[model samples]
Target: MIKLENASYSFKKGFSLSNIDLTIDDGEFVFLIGPTGSGKTTMLRLIYMNILPDSGVVRVGKYSSNSIKKRKIPQLRRSIGMISQDYHLLADRNLFENVALPLHVIGYSKSDMGDLVIEMIEEVGLTGKENHLPDELSGGEQQRACLARALIKDPDIILADEPTGNLDPVTAFDLVKLLEKVNAEGTTVFMASHNYSLIKSRNHRIVEIHGGKLRS
Candidate 1:
């Protein structure tokens, strides 16, 4: 579970988010929608502990989000999978290496790593591209590789910032459906997207952000 209470953030003397109050239950999927600069990315960043809230409280599972010690940030991040608006893959690494990066960092054995990478690649419907580099694949395929990496960790939560933003409509819909499937299996999902119509059709919980404040 994740909870944000009266949270606010500011940068360069400008407020990006304010007084945001929300609670996400375990195994639930939520769509966060708003225009660009409406604080959608900021909110997702807060959940992943990428940025600390200047005020208020953020609790993810049993961890303190904004107040955790610096060294603990990586550990905290490991517990939550994140996808960015752009596919953030290591250009130098093949799909397998990229997906296994996190598991390797945490010290999974070679055999375990290989198995896990294969499983994740299959999970994301990219079974035959494990050896391809990010540059070798199309944008949508690269995004799937990124998602494979995120889910390979099997984090407690999945926070995505427009995971399907750059994909074609059919690909985007498939990705959203995959996210829902992940939610069904008990991982909490918090997705930020500008595709309001797509989100609305799913009938999930939504919390809008505008001018640095959550909507009423």
Candidate 2:
């Protein structure tokens, strides 16, 4: 579960997130829509404990921004998956190595890591491109690779920040469909996007944020 109670944050430039309150139960897929600089990314960062609110509290599962220790932040992040517009893959790494990165951080055995990495790569339809570099993949394929990296750890919730912003419309739709498939498998999905057309036909909860304030 994720909850924000009267949470507010401020930036040095006068932009701020107001007293935001929200609740997302386990296994729910929620869409967050907003324009550029509308705090969509800020909200996700808060959920993952990248930054804490200056006032009030933000909670995810058993972790709370109010009292969580810095040392424990990494442990909290392990349970959450994150994807973004820019595919944050290492340029020097191959697809298999990139996908296996998280497993190494979490201390998985080499034998187990290879099977898990291959399984996730296949799940994202990148089965034959394990040796390829991120630069060699198309925009959509790169995004899928990012998705595979995010899912390899089997996180409880996925926080996608404009994941399809760089893709064509058709590719964008396909990516959302893939996310839907993942959600159906019982993982919660919280995606932030500005593409209304890509999501209007879908049946899911839509939460709108404008000027850092959520719309009722």
Candidate 3:
């Protein structure tokens, strides 16, 4: 679960978010819609505690941004998976290694890692491409690889920041449908997207942000 109450934060570059109050329940699929520079990414950052609010409170599961210890951030992150607009893959690593990276960091056994990583890659519809590098794949393939990496961790919550931003409409729709399948399997999903027209048909809860504040 994720919750924010009267939260506000400002960056040195002059952007500011004010008085945000939100709650996302477990297993709920929520879409965050807003214009560019509307603080949608900032809101997601607060959930994962990438940046703390200058005022008010942010709670993601049991970790509170107001009082979370620095050492516990890794623990918090392990519970939540993140997919960014920029795939952020290690260009040197092959698809399988990229997806296995998180599992390796968490000390999963080699056997478990092999089985789980392949399962996730297949889920994302990239089975044979496992041995390929990021440069060898198309944009959509890279994003799906990122999704596979995120899902391989078996996170309770998924925080996706503009996951479809770089993909074609058809590819984006396929990605959204994949996310819907993940949500139906009981993982809480909170996605930030500016492409409201593409996702509006999904009929999920939509939270809009503008002027750095939540808008009805």
Best-performing candidate as measured by lDDT:
2
What TM-score would each prediction reach against the true structure? 0.96, 0.99, 0.98
lDDT of 1 by residue, 1-115 (tens): 8999988888887766888899999988988888888999989888878889889988888878656888988888898998886888999999999999999878899987888
Q: Pick the candidate with the highest TM-score.
A: 2
- lDDT score for candidate 2 against the true structure: 0.94
- Angstrom error at residue 63, model 1: 1.0
> lDDT of each prediction vs. the true structure?
0.87, 0.94, 0.93
Least well predicted 10-residue stretch by lDDT in candidate 3: 109-118
**Backbone clashes in model 2, listed as residue pairs:** none
**28-66, model 2: which lDDT tens digit per residue?**
999999999999999999999999999989999999999
lDDT of 1 at 184: 88
TM-score attained by model 2? 0.99
Native-to-model Cα distance after best TM-score fit, residue 10 in candidate 2, in Å = 0.3
Predict model 3's lDDT versus the native.
Answer: 0.93
* RMSD, one per candidate, in order: 1.1, 0.6, 0.8
